[model samples]
Target: MLDLRDHFFVPDAPAVELRAFTHGLMPKTVPAMMERFVEDWRERGVDAWNEVPNHWRPGSGEVVGWWTLPETLGDAFIAPLLGAPAGTCIMQPNVHWTVQCLLSAPEPFTAGRNEIVFSEGAFPSVQHSVYQWAAMQGLRPRPLPLGADGFVHVDAVLDAISDRTAWVFLSHVGFTTGEKLPDAALHAVAEKAHRHDALFCIDGYHATGSVAVDVEALGADVYVGGLLKEACGSTGNSYLYVRDGLTLTPRLSGWFADADPFGFQKQPQPHPDVRRRFLAGTTAIASLYHAVEGLRLLLDAGLENVRTDSLAKTALAIEQAEAAGLTLQSPREAERRGAMVILAVKDAAALCEWLKTQGVFTDSRQNRVLRLAPFVWNTTADIERTFAVLEDGLKTNAHQHVVAPASAGPVT
Candidate 1:
């Protein structure tokens, strides 16, 4: 596997960070990118929105200004991560905003279709948006429970699709369980949705950068995700991809999405470019400069290799966990696994805290499952070290006695 640890500023040496599934290590290049942002803002002031140095693609001689970084970066960096073509992708502030915009658009809910289908395993953003939109007087939320196998019930999802279904939303990877739905299953769902004249949308928040995603193959009319996790980009960096020929005029769109903003017309007009219509209000230029640095490293290293590295380390983790008598909550097969592995444990938060004290970082969910994703920056040795601490902690029940620090935040 390609060892790109040197490319990232991994957290303090001798400390193992197993929480790539939550947040990623900062790329060494971010400081320089931030400096360039300051230089551009201080030098040009308001004019920076019109024209700024192309720090994103320096040698390519591309004309990138603060005004166009969203689409420009989407075309150059986010497209490859999604395996999507240029002009079909654009940057958004977050998945919540993107999902809200899609729900607010009238196109998907037209033709008397009034239902949206998704699994209960979806992240709160998708679930919350669907339920919130139900107050619109005609829409119904169809939430299917996971199957006995603890993964999305493919048959139930397919059977739920009907002529009244206006849209079908699915997570490319189950957020709580770390199960990645196979492409064949997603294709089946997409075909059923298309037959019923419903739009198929996917939330790839946990799959992007860690897995090779081909939006076309999955038949997704729309896809949304962020770079805050394994992609290593910080907050305020998310992206959306709309299938070609799809038309959506978001009721939630702001002045930035207007076809002629400077015209200040009384009427609102959607931007001609479908992707640009997702933009709302002024762009956050500072976040854009550092957004693609982590992506650059991943693309150069190759996503397939990244997945391979993750699987190898996670397999080792599972083996060690089993030897230590830890129960697995995530998929045992590599094909069904995303980047993270979840272990069923008692007092998970306390164990997580104890692990942190030992220089091994991990997070827990709902006080039952501890989650970890071994990325390219992690080694098999690190996994072994983590398990060693975990085994000793559990054997002695020492973690149970430790109290959470008063300063610790709610999130593990």
Candidate 2:
């Protein structure tokens, strides 16, 4: 309904992409950005590190170089998305890297506090990193079970926080259920963690562009997310936001994060900028070129508008699913829903494959949960067409007749 399809390059034209929860449509300006990257590399070579044409902020007279693009883009693009202040956010490689960096930091495990509290429904990046740290450090993993409704039980999560809790980890948007945790719930958790002098971190990978976020109001000490999915930027583009005045020294930090690189000191010294301390190695320059292209469209349209569009589209999807007699696996309430909608259908993997044959792209998990997110590029007509095909496929049981691929590769 927003009619922003003109801003994106819809793959294969007529096909309806209902998988923005996994990967977003490429922005129309990516090729030009790529060409600019090629030109800058060709023209400047090694000198590009010190100075290059500021394509990211052209004509604004802002001087940007490859060495500072992480901080520069963080200030121009990511800070506004998170509603965070400047100098507090920086780009990272991915959520996994951010989590690992936090885990490696000595700040969270001070004063004999060794426990990390998180939900069992968390993404592997958070869940796995907590467990990995437990094996190496004097840390304990306290994973709370999901509620009977298959969503986070906020009370249980809050109750789990204690003096032993060093870090409280949670997802702003649950990947498994497409459940968006309410701000009140997140604030309560953050307050509880701070009362006990613990750090609170949120993985907002799926909620970055689709939802309106204010890190200050949420009381998050650290927020990590990526531009790969709903933000429509491609891989190797992730971000981290450290609350102002928070200090963390990571053991896994590489020389790029050193306070002085050319000094070549025998010992490593932490950077004065706390956000820059999260950097590990040489920055991947190519991904930064196209990182904010998609964000430019979303920011230009307004993030609140994007959230409103996502809600309207997802509501239509839920309505269509109910009319088609499919069981909704995701939250039905608009306030608790994220960009994705999940339906519990039999042979979901096969159903996803069949939908692909019908030019409707969706994904499935564990052969039961079929997930789709009707995004900015999708229309109400696209939702109607998808359910039309889904209803027919279910009634005829046609998906069962299809065989799985011999080597289907990765689901995402």
Encode model 1's per-residue lDDT on 110-168: one tens digit a residue: 77889999999999889988889887656899999999989999999999999999889
| Per-residue alpha-carbon lDDT of candidate 2 for residues 15-96, written as tens digits (9 for 90 to 100) | 8898877878899989999999999899999989988878887688766799988999999999999999999999899998
**TM per candidate:** 0.98, 0.98
Shift in Å, residue 283, candidate 2: 1.1
For model 1, what is the C-alpha lDDT against the true structure? 0.89
Q: Which stretches of candidate 2 lie over 4 Å from their true place?
A: 406-408
The best candidate by lDDT is: 2
Which whole-number lDDT from 0 to 100 does residue 144 have in model 1? Answer: 98
Q: Residue 244 in model 2: shift from native, Å?
A: 0.5
The TM-score obtained by model 2 is: 0.98
